[model samples]
Target: MNTLPIRPEIPWLAPLAGYSDLPFRMLCRAHGAGVTNTEMVSAKGLCYFNRGTSSLLNTHPEDAPLVVQLFGADPDSYHQAMDKTLEMGFRFFDLNAGCPVRKVTKSGSGSRLLENPDRLYAIAEIMVNKAGPGAVGVKTRLGWEKGVDTFLDVAKRLEDIGVAWLTLHPRYGKQLFSGQADWSRLAEVKQAVSIPIVGSGDLYTAEAGVRCLRETGIDAVMFARGAMFDPAIFERFHALMRGEESPPRDGEHLARIVRMHIQYTREFDGSDRSFRKLRSFIPRYAKGLRDIRSLRNELISCETWEALESAASRIREMQPADPLGFDPADVIPD
Candidate 1:
């Protein structure tokens, strides 16, 4: 068995629902993202053979080392999902135990799973045993509530169960993307676990990714909202690591990525759902571009690709409304 950590040669693209589809994944990869995860698929959905869930697992020959993240509270469902994934030729899988949405937590899944250490261990053990050799991993937060410290125990348990890697989103579940992520806690978990720790949360810039790696001493940093705000973050980070200044933010470059994203969305999903999902990304990508807020509103009101294209053209032509006055990095959540 090879023992090297699964560190991507470049930064990773964190999974985001309605955003990390194949088009976006390809865009990030082209922009220098090393590893990318599929949007979270429900284990229960996979067990029941949901078509959308199955679509979420779609990958091309080039989308290698891709990890598909599954969420559910049932061990049986997890087993079934892994079996299905293995049959489909997927070698990398991650259990999602960090989502804190009411729907997920109310079902005793996601972040709620961390409240019980034994259950978390059992889940990881089952996946590792069933999936075999370097096949399974876990993504989790510190704990479900504030003032609680369960990450170390959870990380150790996952490591003991033979998890290939673990991604820690350093905020307590209850915090729910508010407040600063506890990077110190991530460092503590890094010290406790023998497995590679992928630090997540609040990594919004190339500088932030570097700082997180240096401070936490982890294997890699995962970008969530950062990738949404700036798909070129990975490319820029790579340049910075090579001692280059930041790349210029070009509206045309942003427009081209957005167009590719829209095309991929249409191909992966049908027109309606693709348009809806693609709309959410426009505002973020257009952050520093001039007149984008108005253009975004027009784009959102669009129903067809032609309408979206017209709006996109207008956006591409407009120079950033505030040159030297705004930062694209600031648009991402902190």
Candidate 2:
């Protein structure tokens, strides 16, 4: 069987909703992410050529080891979408069966798929058949609810269907990242399946990712919220894997990250909407930093690229006391 372009040491970037765009993926890749995924695309949307769906397929030549994630309730449309992506040169695919948003679940996709284990397995089989063996993966939660954990059964079935790998978020659909990500469940899934398992959830730092691998014995980890808060988490993860000290995340270093992301955003998209989104995103990078709240307030009013660049400069020069605690990942409507 063909193995994924990932290992226990090389981390995968999660298919972040509204965030993991081509430019963002490229930025994370530059920092050391081994694999990156496109945000989840609706199969029906792609089949019908929805307005923004095509943009999600945008890629750069350097965006290798990339996976395109798809979500939908219709099997035929899902197959068609997968075929479309495969013909367009994408080699790896992931099913988004873990999103808890009502928008996704109401359509019988996302975590709703978890409630139908048999159907989930059947759809995964179709993915494997369409994408080819060792080229398709499934990403799902532990179950639809806390006490109804079905991941063990689901993982076994997916592996039997020849899925290249499995990425588990280790939380139920309704749990919605409310509590801790049970790393113990990851260990259970790893021992239950012969195929590779990539653990997700609650991995907010390089230390957390490394600790997950050591404790769970899983094949690898995929960083979602962690990467959003700190794209350099991948580089730090690599350092820890090599038994070397991770780079310092001083204010200037973080300022550099802010600058690079801004440059990449301008290079890829300099639209007003893009800048607005960046305004919101940059504050996440400042997570745990003192005197950053006021900077965040200032960013909210930055309407021009020049203005945003100037604010980033201030971020570099100002000496904040220290980083405060990271606010947990917010629950956004997906």
TM-score, every prediction = 0.92, 0.95
lDDT of 2 by residue, 182-225 (tens): 88999999899898889999888898999999998999999988
Model 1 off-target regions past 4 Å? 1-5, 321-334
Q: Residue by residue across 1-334, what tens digits does model 1's lDDT show?
A: 2332356336888877767878788878888888889998998898888778887877777776688888888888888888888899887778888988777888888889988777778778888897786777788998999888788888887887799888999888888778788899888987887888888888878778888888878888888878888889898888877878878777777787777777766766655776777777777777767777788779879888878877776756767756543453455432
- Show the lowest summed lDDT stretch of 10 residues, model 1: 325-334
Which whole-number lDDT from 0 to 100 does residue 325 have in model 1?
30
Cα lDDT over the full model 2: 0.85
Q: Write down the lDDT of every candidate, Cα atoms only.
A: 0.80, 0.85
The CA-based lDDT of model 1 is what?
0.80
* RMSD of every prediction: 2.6, 1.9
Pairs that collide in candidate 1 are 290-320, 290-321
